[model samples]
Target: MSPSKPTSRQFEMQLEIAAPRGAVWSAISSDTELRRWFAPDAKVVPRVGGEILWRWGDLHAWPQVIEIWEPGSRLRTRYDSSIVDGEGGKLPLFLDFFLEGEGGRTTLRLVHSGFGPEATFDEEYDGISRGWPVELRSLRLYLERHAGLDRRLAWCTTTIDLAPAEAWERLTGEEGLAAGSALDALTEGDPFRFTTPAGDVFEGLALCCESRAFSGVATSHGDGFLRIAVEKCGGEHQVWLWLAAYGPAGPGLDELEARWSTMLERLFSASGSMSAGV
Candidate 1:
């Protein structure tokens, strides 16, 4: 019985945060800090070989074991199928976090490795590939701006019979989001302004933008964050919209849920007659 190691395929991401390394380290290691930005709830054991548990509602994001734990430099975790996924046939996965910089700025790099290059591995690989960028944006948001504040999440989702890119157009297009700039002209880190059909105005830097996902900060909404992604679950493409507001002074959560839930339903559901849930 040895430690699990990563296989061939892996993904990496790096971002600069305007926070001290110790603060960045704490945000990734402390359970309470993780809850503020990463997941809805979290639990962490402090030492090497300790557990790092992340939960969204009743579902586990992915339970993992700490492999390396350095104070302000690096932290690595291993994700074994047996203890975490509760399935067979997949290799163990690893998440490595590296921090660099001095003073009030730090560069954080993430490596998620150990994905088998088989067709069966697509779901896990694709999901992680799409998810981490969004999560890390939240991390930077917390450390740089909203440290120590609690977060409230407003989520809405539905499924459509369209491709991810097309769904994105509908999400950011005229009849859809009516953003300040068209999807074709948008790039990551660029400023974006959009008024949702329900009158939610988001004017923030684009955090994540791809064929399948979009996330950004809403400076107008108490610096709230909005993440829109399309995931392929089963036979249909699932549309997920998450709005994160730290502390207070943002829009009403219950009202946002209702408005965006109905917005998504009216936009994507009518064409596909999809199931709507929040």
Candidate 2:
């Protein structure tokens, strides 16, 4: 029998955002605009051979150099630390962005490439494929509704003692949202607005609700975005939550963290499954 063809290492994603080309370009090019939704700390030098960086509060940093910068049209960047080979040497990666617009809407295309045949490379590629769509949804939401707004960040993660499918259901369901201190049901392309018991009101457009996760944009006080996902590993379920609230100031992080932590416990309690931190 012939050997099977090797799996392709490159991936591409397209997002049509409800904004003009200029707006979409800024969302991708400007650091100020990026921090509102994309990453907590972002910097783009706006010139070929300049820098493009994403730093998440000292947790980790991704640094790249710009290769092509065409305003409102295209961008390409190269990162030296994109992959780590088994010999501990760094491999190169490239990211290309293309934008086109008509009728007040912009289509953004992202191409992420530079993976080798190593097992480690395949794992990285899979993780990025799952993550890019969610990140693009956030970019669209920020530009369409929350442009020019600042943001405060809050994130909570927990490992639940339930299966991935079950956890996904409860998290996307109305009751599950309520457990997360959010009182709303999510519907794709529909308005999602709710107030938690803590008196925090969040409003946004529901982007996607699938078997794996639920994601949406914020329309409330600031340009906010959220995504919740469930992954199954080693006979257990892990749920992760990411929330970015737009504005110079908002709810305290301690309170928001506590609320989400409580929500996770409540979710697992309903199924009589005790959770432990991952």
Candidate 3:
């Protein structure tokens, strides 16, 4: 006889919103409204077997393959995180949210299942416990203040250094390679625009710059800071840049950091090579 399969465990959370079922459903169902609270960047195809893409910054926040979509009732999906890790595979788990109407009030029940035998139910449960409160709070505030959708906000920064002479070359080098190339391709004079792998773009602008130093702030997605400076620390032609981003604080911070770090690394390498020849 084959071994009996282990029973799957599930966790759930419930919330009561002082809103009509239709209002609550619209908040979760519409992609634009969903981005206001759940993610700063997201695209949703609300249908069975459709896909939902969520991004927090310059990274893949999380992608969910829709399993069920019942307008004004329930939404079910399978979470997939494989875009970040090559070895990542789909886990035996799924999530569902059921929205029900109750005489001028809306009740939302979130359920997670398929936690296998070795699952850390408590750990997973605890993490989401805190997360939901903050997210939901934002949702409530958004609905009350904006009638349902919150304004999008985001910020980004870039800082680096090079020898004064080399810096000048790149800042004013070949006709098409001056200030245009000094900054990231996504950057334009004054305002800088960055597009994530998932196709979500953020807009900002240069706020400051000087000899061997540059800084900027962008407004639209949120508040972002960027700085670039050059100094001979330990005499090795060091260039340092710092970018601190702030937005809705979604599920893509780690991935955004990784992608930005790689981009900066490449920028530094190329700048260094040019500096060497100066």
Q: Using Cα atoms with residue i matched to residue i, what is each candidate's TM-score against the true structure?
A: 0.83, 0.72, 0.48
Model 1 residue 171 CA deviation in Å:
3.5
Error of 2 at 150 (Å): 1.3
Candidates arranged by TM-score, highest first: 1, 2, 3
List per-prediction Cα lDDT, in the order shown. 0.78, 0.72, 0.54
lDDT of 2 by residue, 111-220 (tens): 99887666767556766777788888878777776777776666665666666667776765555564342323546777776665556566777777655776776656
Candidate 3 residues 166-247, lDDT tens each?
6534432332113344443332246665444434444566644444555455353344444444433222444433343433
Candidate 3 lands at a TM-score of 0.48
Report the lDDT tens digits of candidate 1 across residue range 1-278: 99776557889999999999999999999999898888778999989999999876532367899999998999999976422344555458899999999999999999998877666777778878888888898898877778888888787777677777778777767776676235445677788777876687778877788766778887777888878777775445777778888777444877877777777877876656433222
Worst 10 residues of 2 by lDDT: 269-278
Which residue pairs collide, candidate 2?
Answer: 150-247, 203-219
**What's the candidate order when arranged by decreasing lDDT?**
1, 2, 3
- Model 1 spans > 4 angstroms off: 1-7, 58-60, 81-89, 173-175, 233-236, 268-278
Q: What lDDT does model 3 reach?
A: 0.54
